[model samples]
Target: MTRSRKTTQPLVKICGLNTLTVVDAAVDAGADMIGFMFYARSRRAVTPDLAQALGEEVTGVTRVAIVVDATDAEIDAITATGVIDMIQVHGKEDPARVAELKARTGLPVMKALRVATKEDIREAEAFFGAADHLLFDAKAPKDMKGALPGGNGLTFDWTLLDGLKIDMPWMLSGGLTADNVAEAIRLTGAPGVDTSSGVEDKPGVKSPERIRAFLAAVKQTHLETAT
Candidate 1:
């Protein structure tokens, strides 16, 4: 389900990286950022020690720690590892909390907004100045089984973000893959793109081939668009 080779080369982020092998695959695939999940409820959850080790192996790629409404203690434990470059809040954190987490961890914050409607996009305004970056993701249906915060692999209407202006840097995520990512970028003009299950063989298992293909697809977009 991929598109013709196009190349916008939007800032690519590979999320839900757990093991060192997958980490290497993402890094080798030219990911701009690598995300490690810390939410205990998630199948992709990794311990702080593991994240630290994996983060150490990466040189150029930014390492991000993903949490869902985590307590100060939980966040402290993860940041204490010193491997994470950014903290991604995937929970219902208010702007004050976002600011507090940024100050406490001394790392830039990316707040995720689960969009089900246009109002959800509007909600992002609250985090404008509080967070360093914004991530727009699909909001899981209330009846969906075992739904986690951000990686449900559901796609919202890209047209919702078309011509929408916001202050902070942002990334387009949720159900993005090599197949449709080019169109997604074209529709939204996103500065960056993120993928979790889209590159995985299963919920937590990352396929190296898929990772390489996804990156190649993203890079192709930049090439096609530049010409």
Candidate 2:
């Protein structure tokens, strides 16, 4: 639903914000989007009221909700608060579920596709027209114990997506930080980027300084990559 892929500004989204300081840093640092974790299973989860409070601090950054395998009631309850601008489904929600949620909320939906191999990208085809955006994250290992779905800070082979193309717009995430986001962006040609643990000092704790550093890295990345 956004502009065509031919334009590239490299939008950056800073996720897992649970504090005002980090929120301010992201905004001041020029992040295009800011995400709040609402999944109870995630260590970075925040309450609806708290999300509203945090959202108030961001005057311009797009507010986002990162949700997991939640029910309609849960999603609606959060949407009712009227603070979230986008809903990021980081679970096993299929294309039909994506359509249902979009119809009910009248809000844009971002479908997350966890990638570990070439075939994984095809899994996202179903969501092309169904979702407003796509987020590519590293797939969690099936046998690895204690994997808590998305936001595990897993990193896949970035090279796997080199020169890749897709119908729907997408963002790249997973183990991305200020240190390597530029190289990752160059390799994958991802038009947008999302960061979680990469900007946090600890699980559920975001650092303002880290946020600034991260934004600076992306600005530099954009310059270096541009001819």
TM-score per prediction, in order, is 0.95, 0.93
Candidate 2, TM-score vs. the true structure?
0.93
lDDT of 2 by residue, 89-150 (tens): 99999999999999988999999989999888778778878999999999999998778767
Assess the local accuracy of residue 11 in candidate 1 as a C-alpha lDDT between 0 and 100: 89
Worst 10 residues of 1 by lDDT: 1-10
> Which lDDT values do the candidates have, in the order given?
0.89, 0.85
| Cα-based RMSD of candidate 1 | 4.7
Best by lDDT: 1
* Residue-wise C-alpha lDDT for candidate 1, range 113-212, written one tens digit per residue: 9998999999998887899999999999999999999888899998899669986789999999999999988889888999999999999999898999
Taking every candidate in turn, the Cα RMSD to the unseen true structure, in Å, is 4.7, 4.2
lDDT value for model 2: 0.85
* Cα distance off (Å), candidate 2, residue 199: 0.8
Candidate 2: C-alpha RMSD to true structure equals: 4.2
Cα error of candidate 1 at position 49, Å: 1.1
